[model samples]
Target: MAAPLTDAGEFESWLNDRLDSLEVDREVYGVYILGILQEEESDEEKEDALQGILSAFLDEDTMEDVCKQIIKQWTECCSRSAAKRDAEDAEVQAIASMIEKQAQIVVKQKEVSEESKKRKEALLAQYANVTDEEDEAEEEEQTSGNNFTGNDKSLFKNTNVEEVLNRQKQKRDQAREDAQKKKEMDKMQREKDKLAKQDRKEKEKKRTQKGERKR
Candidate 1:
């Protein structure tokens, strides 16, 4: 008598404990629990208990189908969440790379501007020096006394003026040439800088692509 009572109480208590630990699929467990509780207190009760236990624990054919469905849905949800997180991380990384590229461009542009300013200052200084030299030469010619024959006087005057004009023209031409050379050199340097920057950008792009491939 005690052994039969113990067996009945054991099944009932086990069912109650497992039902309390439920998270989902509550309807299935509810139907089984009710079926067990309503069974007669005889061999019928034992048979019902066995049937309910088989339904709850022996999940080989019918319950295996439900578990497969639950696992499939759970796997899909986890995969979708992981993919969304990965996409967001990639977007943030792209934005950060763009910001770095723009910063490099700005730095290169500032360096070019500074170089141009320095070149202009150098040209202005050279022009000022040439102008001062010309003024000094003109003053010396005007201070020289007139002591010569008529033809000699006329030749000296015309030659002196021509020499001064020619010297001034030569100075102007030299200044122009120097400024032009500086501008051309600066242009070439800027082009080289641009090329180097482009190379760096290409390398960074390759690195980013490699990282994505690894992922």
Candidate 2:
């Protein structure tokens, strides 16, 4: 009997963490991905494939890409295998149905994992804005420095620090979001410039080659 498929989230994290180690070969890693998805694969084959995958996973990006690829193939395999077979088979039919359900479960797990990842990144990115607000609040308090004077209970009665801080926070958060937007725009521009430069170089090289042939 083939082994059951592994959890997508756990497998994804495991691969990505290994990629952080900086020694995995992409070709070998690809093979390992295939090997792992082949349930009922022999123990020897599994160990050999894992050894390669374990070697160096320095590219989180690559791992993520491979995660999708693996899941895609695994789902297909499960679906194809799940087709009802003939010849004496309540148990067999049940097993096939279970594999089909497992395929659906794995796909859902992938969706949930991607959503959770986006939420985590958004929270982390927003953390800088929270820090910015705290710093601003501290600076305001420092600069204001005890101007209230002689207010045992008569000089001031309408002070809402919470409301003020919240307003300030809202402004700071908006500013931070705007800055992030600009930064992404700038990064995209840089990539475009890089691509244009490469294209220009390729054209120049082709023109030089053509001229040399004529000479």
Candidate 3:
């Protein structure tokens, strides 16, 4: 068996800070101790033994239930000693005080939770604004700048608007301007060749006429 609780102070300390999983067992243990005090145990001895047998457990409401049962049994079965009454009274007061402190702690925890929630909401709102700005920038780049969406790339089979425009420029130069320039250069070279042929024919005709006169 586990060692018994040795002090009245130990009960209240456990009630304030110990795990709640054992609460039912502790309350049931309190009931068992009450049942055993029906015999002629000294009030002092009973209180001390009760402490050693049961750790402090239960909330204020449940504690009041256990205290009522213990007080009633002590009065009826044991001697109605003043010291025992005083001691039980002090124990009841201490339990009440611990309950009040727990209530205050709960209120403080709620306030802190609300503060954390507010901060989280503020952070989310700020992040949403930043995300909106980035989305706008991307949309503008898609419409006007040299960028392409995945759908745009697949649909057009091109990277960006700039590439499309540059390809169109090259097509225009090849189809109209470059062809016209080649035609003009050909016409000039043909005219120059014709003029040289005409000059040579005229000079040959003049030389033939002079030779005939000399003969």
lDDT of candidate 3 over 1-215, digit per residue (tens) = 22222233433334333324444554456446534454425555555555555445555565555544454544543343445666899999999999999998999899989999999999999999999999998888875453355665565555456688899999997889888998999899899899999999999999999999999
What's the number of clashes in each of the models? Answer: 0, 7, 1
| Candidate order (TM-score) | 1, 3, 2
Local accuracy of candidate 2 as per-residue lDDT tens digits, 110-158: 9999999999999988998898999998876765565443452233333
lDDT of 1 by residue, 152-207 (tens): 77888899999999999999999999999999999999999999999999999999
Which of the two, 1 or 3, has more TM-score?
Answer: 1
Which segments of candidate 3 are over 4 A away from where they belong? 1-80, 146-215
Maximum-TM-score candidate: 1
lDDT of each: 0.63, 0.65, 0.63
Q: Provide TM-scores for the models.
A: 0.39, 0.27, 0.31
| TM-score, cand. 2 | 0.27
lDDT of 2 at 55: 37
As a whole number from 0 to 100, the lDDT of residue 143 in candidate 2 is 52
